[model samples]
Target: MPCDKSANADPKKEFFIDVITMDIDYPDCILDLIDNSVDAYTRSEIDDPQIRVTFGEDSLEIYDNCGGISEHDLLNTVFRFGGHVAHDSTDTLGIYGVGLKRAIFKIGNAFEFETYDGVNHNIVYENDLSEWKTRDDDEDGKWRFKVRAGAELDQETHGFSELRITKLKDSYKKMVTLDAKIIEEISIKYVLFMNRGLSFWVDNLKIEPLFNFEVLSNEYLQPSVKLLEKDGLKVKIVCTYNPRESLRSEREEGRYGWNVFCNDRLILLSNTTKETGWGELGNIAFHQLYYPFCGYVFINSHDVRKLPVKTTKNGLVTSDNTYKFILNEMWNQATPVLKYLRTSRLMDEETLIKDAEKSANEKVLQDSKLARSNADQKSIFSMNEKASFKAPDMKPKRKELTKIQYSRPTVQVDKVKRKLGAESNKKVGELTFDLFYDEECDDA
Candidate 1:
């Protein structure tokens, strides 16, 4: 009897490609690549950081004048799937090193990286990617980039990286459309960077910092610090609430929420609902409340494991205790302001905050401190079903059934497989996911 051992092997090329491209659309993929460029600026502390994106008929490219990649990083870091990087900087957006590579595989079959530092200019790409994986281990497996004195790089932009994704894959050709929602999301996500002198351009058009909904009545409550001893977490919170008339009640919870940031990068764009921390604490019906609210929680932590984000970097795990503390803090200050907004009914937002700030400070501080203590586990302001009159649960009476069941009618679905129609390289009658193209952008 003998124990059998399996040999280690590289993942098959198609499986690797498919896994790399999962769970992200074109807009998110493009944004991931930009995150790397932003990290360069964060690391180098470069002033006047500029990111330019261009749309080509059959290709797309991203250009940034940040720090350029070196030979070692080009070969080992950038091209390597699942390239490992440690979470070294709290301020930098990049943690996982797979962003740029995944983005490339998402958009096109082959892409080129053109970069220049003060001394060297470099270019790298691999054609026929599938061939590399099939090559025998004994054959030379080394693949390195080409470096030269001048690589079509401008002298003025000495230190920079330019990524061009070309030869569009059949599945990703519609990425060129550039939807309005994508632009709005980018503008909101990067407003702080834009304010700090980073210029972001999309297809020769400059993206402006999107403005928040106007506040009617407001209050700048005393800032709060909550220390969760068991978790070793600290949250510093500042909050503002809109007046009763500021937001349309009919419009519901439209954009009234927390804009949470960790080390200055936005983690949760809008934490605006009961599950997001407002439900039990605020007590007021979310959709019925006249006043809208928003706030920020700047976090400092002893343990990086407690960070309130997923690897995708799209949003916070709002269910985490850290976010729950923040939402609760915002609600404590918001209660009095909402009460005033209802009774006083002020037209001017400025005067409301000024007035609320004077009266709410003491209560806000006491509640915030008490929340951290084990002695007072329950928030006094929060509502219980018995104390606050919640409607009694009544189960619906079951309908009597006797010989009433019948089988559903059979519906036939026509499934047709087709190839791309008259495409230069594709066979006739190629089928794509049926996306609706007739609907136009509201302004377009």
Candidate 2:
């Protein structure tokens, strides 16, 4: 064989620089960038964190006081896919690095990021979708995106990063009117963040808290048992019901399970709708033993995926055992409470009326205490007397009976009369009279 230099040569090419690019649709790109902000905030250990969003007709900006990316890391790894520091680590909230770029590409034509890297070193990048579609053979096949050195960055400013997206898509034009509402919705959806030191703002309005209970202290029920070994399992059961009203229609059906979280971040929310055994037993009106209210029994710290239930972000698909176990525990706890309430006369109509009357009398006395400070105390007392005099005399109505009927007895005397022969009966009576009735007959 002739000597061939190319046959023995390595074909792979190596590059020294670390820049990667991908195209993303507008709002989606923006969302991915926000995810990056959230991950960064979580990593910094800044408790009760908040992210600020501001936008106008031409531009949109998101700012967060998270642990900003370091200058060296930003240049080398931040933009590259699969470069996340938290990958494969269950404690942290970040995964693939695609979120940052995906967010930028989805929302705007051009985007810039500035991070506090001891000193600020801003990076500006622009994407031209039209250029991406049309490139000649001589040009590099990679998508057309440009990155360049940015101006002096500030570092003394505790840690911060800002992403600004401009050159809006047509779909985003309507969003200008709904920015506040969107923030509100997101805040409600991620209400757990209120306990995790995460806060969100849109324009000037701060999102109000949406949860009724404290996430760590009250929202999470106490465990019945703790798992000591790898195979150990813990179960929690909670049931609540509305006594005065049904919040949902009777036509609506399904079990409502919460999003499970480990270390303050959401792992998954259930995607199933089948009622657990506990739900079926708890839902009965007569079995007020269990409060059938809107709450969840969270099996804390366990990988619930082990249960035979299909879970997605929306609902849970529960199997027989999971439901059965939950129902058994719930009934065990709730039955006593229901019995106590019933025995205490709390559920009785007459008891409630008496309690109401007592309450009203107490209120009147309380109002009299305040009358010393009132300018129209005498008039108020006079009005009370007049109202009492005008009260109508009424009697409680009794329920009426609809009809009455009587039936004769099935047994008759004719059969008994035929069984006794008259002649034999008289002879026996005469023999008895001769022996015992002599004194009674003489007196008669």
Candidate 3:
């Protein structure tokens, strides 16, 4: 038998657009643009990288102060679909190379790219794809692209890229209505980065991370930190459990649960996403898991092989064993603290205090057992250090002791040279006399 030929399954332009939008949410599409921004920043080695996502009435825009594309990148790969860039070899994000294009197509039928590198005044570039949105006859394989170069950009500053997408699809136009939702998503999605000085802005409102500490200052358990190391890679797990009452206030609405990160990028922010708590793939329910425990699993290694992130970089691959392993650890430590909280709540008033004390002791014992398997420094989370909720009631009894005093008799010398010893004496005009002596003086 002889094989006739090999064939390539090249997709149509429409199909390519569909593929990018099908599995993604609009918010995540915005994140794709940020991923490229981050990659650009990494390549340019820019300091104080800043990203702004604008929610416009008729358009959606994402702009970054990262270095603009170089001539090589612009000509060889910036606009090439399914193209691989040299930077991909590095550990920067957005490896698939179509994130920019996919995001552009998904958001609207028309888009314009404007960019400027800090140097090379003649290297500015812009590509307007407004006409391609209506051109259905040209197939993806035969379509061509030409980037138009322009003079110094309207802005005086160097090193910037601005992506503007307009002419939105009817349904996609609804993206503007997502300002409130995007604020929350960006806050959580980039909590790690924001806390580390990545400034993000929506419209004019700047996005900032929550308190930058590992544990809350309110009534919460001491953070449990565990570190796992194999070869040179490290994964850290830090967790804490707070009573639901602490979060009962409206301000704490979306602050409960896990906030997982990979190489300093937040994948899950505070378990706001139900997938991390209770969902089809999740075996644990938020309520059933005691309601207010959050764990942060961080992969210190930037190596893609060790980092547990889905293609979107917004979540972990639930099916991956290592991912599941981290989740399991989070559950294992969190379950006890939550159970303790629930148990304390359900106990009868008469037994609540005693039960709580007993539970605290038992928790410390369990933590001690866990401590055996983990090194003090390299563990994901340290086991519980005593009961975190118990308060001390000082109770020390006072001691009763007796005291004794001793005195010596004083010898008194009279002016006429007679000496006498007195048990008690007082001095009057240079003469020492006992109480009896005063009476004797009165008699004299």
> Could you say which candidate leads in lDDT?
3
Tens-digit per-residue lDDT, 1-444, candidate 2: 866556534221111111222333344444455666766765676645678888778778888888677876776667654566543232333345556655554455667777774465556465553343243323443332345555655545567788887786566666655575556544544455554557777786777645433111111121112112122234443332222211122311112232333323333332122243322533323322122222334343233333333222222344546545554554554444333322221222232334445555544333222321223212111121111001011112223634433333334322221221112333323333433543345422
Query: What TM-score against the true fold does each predicted structure earn?
Result: 0.64, 0.51, 0.64
Candidate 3 all-Cα RMSD: 23.8
Candidate order (lDDT): 3, 1, 2
**In model 3, which runs have C-alpha deviations exceeding 4 angstroms?**
1-8, 42-48, 84-91, 120-144, 153-156, 216-222, 229-233, 243-255, 272-289, 300-307, 339-444
lDDT of 1: 0.55
Clashing pairs in 3: 225-380, 225-381, 225-382, 226-379, 226-380, 226-381, 227-378, 227-379, 227-380
User: Candidate 3 on 1-444: residue-level lDDT in tens?
Assistant: 779887977566666667776887777788878777766665666568888988777788888888887767766677777665654334566656777887777777666777778654322222445556335544534655546665665555758888888877677775555777778877776666676567888898998775453443322224555667643346676665443333243425234577777766677766734455343243334542234555666675545555667877867777776666666666665655554543332212223334435456544343333322222223223342322322111111222645434334333223211221111232221223322343355431
Candidate 2 C-alpha error for residue 30, in Å? 5.1
- The parts of candidate 2 lying over 4 Å away from their true place are 1-31, 81-83, 87-90, 127-129, 132-145, 153-155, 215-272, 275-292, 296-444
C-alpha RMSD for every candidate: 17.2, 21.9, 23.8
